[model samples]
Target: MLDFSFGAVAMGHLVACVFFLKFWSRTRDELFAVFAAAFALFALEQVLIAWAGLPKEEQTWFYLLRLLAFLLIIAAVLRKNRRWS
Candidate 1:
């Protein structure tokens, strides 16, 4: 059940990444490009988790990868917001 869920989540992330890429292609928006990259990292993390069989005990580096993805999102938002300036 857990393995199935991980696979589903990974696939979902990949789909999102593709969609973001399409959006970036149409609009040429750097935000969408960054989002696609972040989602790709998310997919990679999910695949690693599933393949490594460490659902509960992910290593520090994996968590860092997740952190980087989230940070990418936050950075994008901040960069886009005028109030942050």
Candidate 2:
């Protein structure tokens, strides 16, 4: 059901976070560090969504976490590209 899907999504986020952290460690890259943080936030957001059991209408706040994660990714990319120029 929905629970299963949420759990799977959370696990996927966690796995992504771990990989990003590993890449950050190996390369000492700020982009990887930002990515790891974003994924970690996403994983936490999924856990909160699954556990809170909030109604769809009230889930807007939860989605902000996702928005923030994406914004972080965008900001990092912009910063990187600007630095290269």
Candidate of highest TM-score:
2
TM-scores, all models, native as reference: 0.85, 0.94
lDDT of 1 by residue, 1-85 (tens): 9879989998999999999999999999888999999999999998888788764755556777789999999998888885557
- lDDT per residue as tens, model 2, 1-85: 8978988999999999999999999999999999999999898898889899989898889989999999999999999999999
Mark the regions of model 1 whose C-alpha exceeds 4 Å error after superposition. Answer: 58-60, 82-85
The deviation in Å at residue 9 for candidate 2 is 0.5
Location of the lowest summed lDDT over 10 successive residues in candidate 1: 54-63
Candidate 1: RMSD to truth: 2.3
**Per-residue lDDT for 82 in model 2?**
98
Judging by lDDT against the true structure, name the best candidate. 2
Supply the global lDDT for candidate 2: 0.93
Compute the lDDT of residue 70 as modeled in candidate 2: 97
